[model samples]
Target: MLRRGNEGKKPLKEKIILHYDILFKSHGDDSFDTPTFWEEFFLLKAHPDYIEKKFESFVAKDLIQMKDRLNFLFEKCLEYIQCDQPVRVINALQTMSCLFRGIHSVEVGDHGFDKINLLVGFDMAETSMQVLLRCLTAGLTNDHYNTTIKAVILQLLLVIATGTDNISQNTFVEYLMTNEELYDTLLELLTDPVARSRLGNDTVLLLALMVNYRKYEGVNPFVMRLSVLDDELALSCLGSVISSAFASFNKQFVSKQEESKSSGLFSTITNMVGSMFIGDSDEQKQMIKSNEAILLALYEAIHLNRNFISVLTHSHTDATLVGTPPHTPGGTDDESVPSQPATPTPESFVDASTTRNVLSTFLQYTSVVMQDTKLKRNISSTKLCFIILTCITEDQFANSFIHDENMSFQVCIHKMPMRHRKVKAIVEKPGAPLACWLLDLTVEFIVSHMMKDLPFSQHMRCLGIIHRLMCHEKKCQIRLSYNWRELWTALINLIKFILSNESAIFGRWKKGIFALFTLVINIFNMFITFGDTFLPTPTSYDELYYEIIRLHQVFHSLENFVLRHNANPEYKDVSSRLASSMVNVLAIVRHFNPKIEQYMKDNNMASLTEEEVLEIVKSNYDDLTLKLQHSLDHFERYSERPKETHFFTELVRSISEQYRKTMVFDNIDLQDFMHF
Candidate 1:
């Protein structure tokens, strides 16, 4: 019995010491003849039966004896990797990666992996990183050993990155930061096609861990270096880095099933991208100052990936109508010809659904950036906003984005105030400021696009966005003082064009008319509520009066159109609502008119009668009259359609009752006007 127990214990104890000696006793000068020995040893260590039975006991007993062995092994592996024998080098790397994985898998309860502190405490983490960096550089430069060696190198790098203690992670980060060549080499490798395909996500995670370590340690060497790079190189580097990160995020997190691993991967990528702009120093601010192209590239990458996610999640089908000729009024299908199946064209990345998602994602990212107070003050941030303005204002994106009421255009509008505060602070600077430019661009887009020929829904959307801007207190305050004249002129022209076009007034464009009315009301309310800021100078009173007169004529034309259409059941509610809007317009004009007349009287033109005033405004008054007459004539042809003549009876009676109560209209019969 004693001899059997000794025999059984002898081999187990010998095997443990043999593994420890191979790991620790190896040195850089050792011969490469033992490559198979190390490979076989790692293969034995990876076996399930050995792990389940002997691995824990072996580690608990031999881990202390193997003190600093990982460091020596890392050095020996590096030496072998640099040797001329390809087989020895590959085997050395595979053995190194498997050993690291095995060490990382040994867990002690609540203490994390047991052997990670060996590398970190001995200050060997940097050496491991150097080896991994060398492998990455090699994989990138030599295409012959790309896939096999590169993948194993990445696995080793990730094991060190994610499976180590925080001190070890920081030590690795320090190596990456202090070696600029290594940093740039890693980025170059990331952009390389072969390296990216084999090791993109792992590289991204490593980069993220470095950034996060810097954050925790409060030493931002990488970001500091990024700040001082030449503009072109900096932009190129950022573009490549962010594009690769976005690709990884799309593949692992957005396109795949949402597992915990993928979620962690996405979080790391996000942290990496965000770390670039997170610092508060002037250098960090300068990193984003003039790099509009870089920021735009990042934004577009996220936008594209977001679109990919939407496509993957949504169910999309395409139906094509092919090989079918138009039929005559009484034609039937021919019996002799066989019909062919309509083949559906494959959906592409730029399909309508994807395009819509691209727009949505663009807006969402724009909103996020705008709301980030850290970035809000950066010039590049403003430029990013300018890019978004340019996109949404363009005919293609705008026309498509606005027609979908389900879109978040309104949500973006609501977030403009955050941007408004930032832009307001810098509005008066010498160069073209973003806030002023965006406001001017918005006006230009509205005037150029919201025409009579456009669809009513499109027009309504354009007007709705404008209404939101007009109602935004900050935008109104700034715009009312800076670009109010240009904005007012463009809006007046739009209103005149809409009122003059009979189709706009009476066709299926009631929503558009209502939107236009709401925009005008908001503008007028801004002028009224902010009287101290918006009041015209005494010298400008005549121009203001002329504007009020033009508005009065517009309101009168609108009132007449509503009265004519009030008898049509289709237009009954719309006409009534518009009539009420007209009453509000009249009241606004009435309140401002007396004040303007008093100014005119106090200035010089007290003797001008109503006829004189009409003569002075003859050109605009004639224009208004001609438009109203044309609309009335157009409606006269449609007058024979079924009408509820009593639609306006209550409306007219209310007006007469108010007039009788306020004024001495002697011998007036309200019933006469109520009959319509």
Candidate 2:
């Protein structure tokens, strides 16, 4: 039996040394023959104090003194990994984790000197590669081990892969490239919730690391795998993992809320009083770290997987809604209309599809992250979240934003580190599409950064998402048409915010403003060219009138800014494009100005006020100087503009591409993008 505390009143160092001496003296070269050696050595190594404290504090010299013994133990671990006994394999794997962590903690010599020396002295790189491959092949291919043993094996492999150098990692990755059985095993574990639970996040982390291999020397095996695997299964597995992480975070948040709503007034007061003195609890911080880890895993998965978005869209089939009038331009059927449900019912509305569930979870977690002051400022987490969102919006699917479920959340817009304004909770209308809710949140998020002097790349990411969403994807376009009023309102607010802030258009924010202008112009061009195709609601003309007037005013102001800032050569292209965009929009505005004027006169309405009329009159193209017209084009070419990729994204892509070309993953400091 294992001894409890105080049964052996000896110093841990002394116990370890004495036990080692006894084992060596008794068994010599035959130590593997004795069960006592395995049991006692594992007991000492597995001791909480030893594993946590002693191993962590061990230096290079300390390891050097026990180099021979460490090598022996490592060799034994390799043997035990390949052994038939499951208990032996588990114990060996655990022991290997402890030893590898200790070796990885060598902080004595200059920089990576100690780590390299230790790895070389123990011959860990080559031996670990062999053992790792063998374990994966054996554990996955046959019934030689159970789930527990397989999980332990992967745990050990993670430690090795994390601590070892490139050669070992490359070897393991190369093996996985062609090893179909191992790949299938990983996929099975990802899809099987029970198996995933048993394996924990280790499997997910392992696959994430594998997929992150961006060697462009040849075909990327993981990307190749994406082409071969079932799209639905791939999306379902990844989406489930992401959802589970967010669910855990939501549970904690909900629990905190529930604690405030205790059974009675006294309990509520007690909880409130306790909360005043307490900071973020340990559990919440742990969940934050867990969330960061899961987000990083997802970042790696999507960053490296080529078909991720396609798989995301493929998870849901195209279906239409009943009671929705068919969208026809000029009273003719439009081919751009996607298929819909013939009869809309509660059952039809409950699209518990994989893609919808994943996006819903994203929106839910985003609300939570924005509300929490600490998480709101977590640049890495926030950036990763937006990057994922940007990828999600790259493709449009059927009923992309329509959901029966309610999505109500609050966003706290912070003007400073400690000072914030809690915007009113955005409660969705009974049948409001998810697009409106998402737009509300996004607009609030962008508006929050308008006055703050911070990096705007993440804000640009938000714009990119919206830009892609507004693309001519039929399903998304048709659905958004119904919510055009809400869409126009949100977009106008964003345009007003961007243009009115002089600082936003001047220096660092200049490029983002240019991109924003391009996106807005694209969206504007779409509506102008296709407005007739949408079903004409009773308020369509009125909505279009006000929006066109708003656009006319905004663009006129933008044109005035361009003419005033003509001294800077750097602003030439954007100024020219801005002028071109204005020319296109103003022509449309001129055509509608008289119609709106007539409607207001006939209805005796205040809709087309004198101030709005003056704004439209000033928007005439003939008012521009001849020199400006000579420099500008009458029409904006609707060519395929390259998607707005971030500096951070471009940096990652370049690094990955270079690594692929040279078979070397460069040491780049991506701390800005990495949370964990």
Candidate 3:
């Protein structure tokens, strides 16, 4: 017998086998696992790290003389896994994970894998499967090191169920459906926390692989059932898997090739979102908010699925944010200052009634503008903004949505006081039924969120728009004698409420604002065209008379806010680069007349129709060439021509076009439009 040196009493897993093999030839009737010393020695083999490479020569000697010591080890695993000790049964899963690692890194080819696979399939009972599920589940919450092992086993099973290259895929797929116990075992693993966290997003990655392999089913009910799970972790896993299935699928996999599974992922996600709150209990809700692992998983799911993302992000009617902050705008009251409101602004020329009515009209018109889907908005931004804006203005506009009180279709008619002292009302009709209701709900949500605890940038962007509209000449109506200083003062004070206190918008919110602002700027151009015009081009301006008051109010508001921020040590330079440039445009807007009103009046041009007058104005209007150039020169001294860049960009783009123009008209779908 070859005597390998015994260092720290190595397990006779090899030695006992070697002794048995030698006896099988030279001697006879030898078995192992003696009560104390040998059992203790075998226990040491449980931890392979203790057996150093210094003993490698001994390991080779033992294997050469012994009969497959590793195969003998796995036989012990099968025997003890279902025995008296359930706690030690978990060790089998760890050993299995390690075994797979050994097979991948240690085994060379099909021969090694076949040996490994044969070991894995060693006739396990239903109890064994359940125990493995429980072990995987428990391991998820176990210490970090244990989680690494459990994850490997789960990945192996997932791949075994789906992958093309794996021999286990065909058998596992059939077993998943017909083999009820097997399917339940897989389900139990999914509900396990440690396994899920380990898998993270790879479950989706695997599903993508499944679809690509043409081994996928159409509208799987098991996936559907899992999606409806009340547990956030399970739901999140389901959602990620669903989104991945959708994304993983491409034009390559069609009905002709793989029996078109078109709505499987979409239906799964939609149903999940619709029922996210249904039957979800207190424990589960708390579990969702506090669990960082689960929250990240849920966010990933929400991020990937378009329909699910829409419901979560938009704050619409049916789906609302659960733990939203309270709404407080730091706003002054409307004339009647409650104990809470510090001091209200002093009145200018326009009364509160007229101002409110004007705002109401603006809201209604804005609702119409928002709900106009004829502009071909094929994506999320178009839908989200239009939906949100409509919902916000729903209370203000009667036509766009059915009022809760009457549930009747009614036009929101605002009385405009004509020069002759006669009042004429302007009415905008409602859009389609579904669109109007959805939009109205979204509007209400936005207004509610706007008033609530939100980031300051939200207030700054939204309120800035509102303040600009309020101070429009048609609404503000400040007389020529009225000091521009007081108008500036009124506008400035309001901005203080908006950017008052908060974290700045520097990331996604900033980018989203830029996108929204793009729409707003286009809308502003439309609004400007609809206003007083002496244009050669329809989009051109009346200039000197209309006050261009929206831009003026915004300018004043920004300047006041910036100066205030700079004054406060905490807030200095925090107004953002976006705020400063707004002031520059406001400063120079005074120079643009398009065609000087006095010069045109001296030439008896007041009688000319606006369209005819537009031609002369277009030829004469050198807003970019002369006035903006002059403003840019002055701007360089103070703010380094911040506004000039945007001003010139617009000025050059607009002025070069042909002067022949019509008013920026309200285009509506008469087929869908319901008038009151």
User: All models: lDDT?
Assistant: 0.42, 0.51, 0.32
Q: Order the candidate numbers by TM-score, best to worst.
A: 2, 1, 3
RMSD of 3: 25.4
**Candidate 3 Cα errors over 4 Å, as ranges:** 1-45, 48-72, 90-93, 110-118, 121-222, 230-296, 299-676
lDDT of 2 by residue, 1-676 (tens): 9767896686466565555444223235545447677655543423323453555656667667656666666667667767664445555667666666566556545444455345434346555645556676566434434344455567665654454333223333454555555556777666654445445465665665555454334576765675455557755666566655665565456555456345468644554443321115666655654465466556555555544544333223112111122222221122123334365666333233323344555566665564333343255567667776665554334224332224322222111111233222233344344554555556556655554353466666666555455453332234343456655665666666666766734566775676676566656555554444442453453455457675677766666776765566887777677667666566656665665678678879877665555445445434422222331112222111233234233333333232222221112222311221
Cα error, candidate 3, residue 164 (Å)? 13
lDDT of 3 by residue, 467-531 (tens): 23222322323111112222233333333333342144323253344333223322233223332
TM-score of each: 0.36, 0.67, 0.29
Ranking by lDDT: 2, 1, 3
Error of 3 at 408 (Å): 32
Itemize residue pairs with steric clashes in candidate 1: none
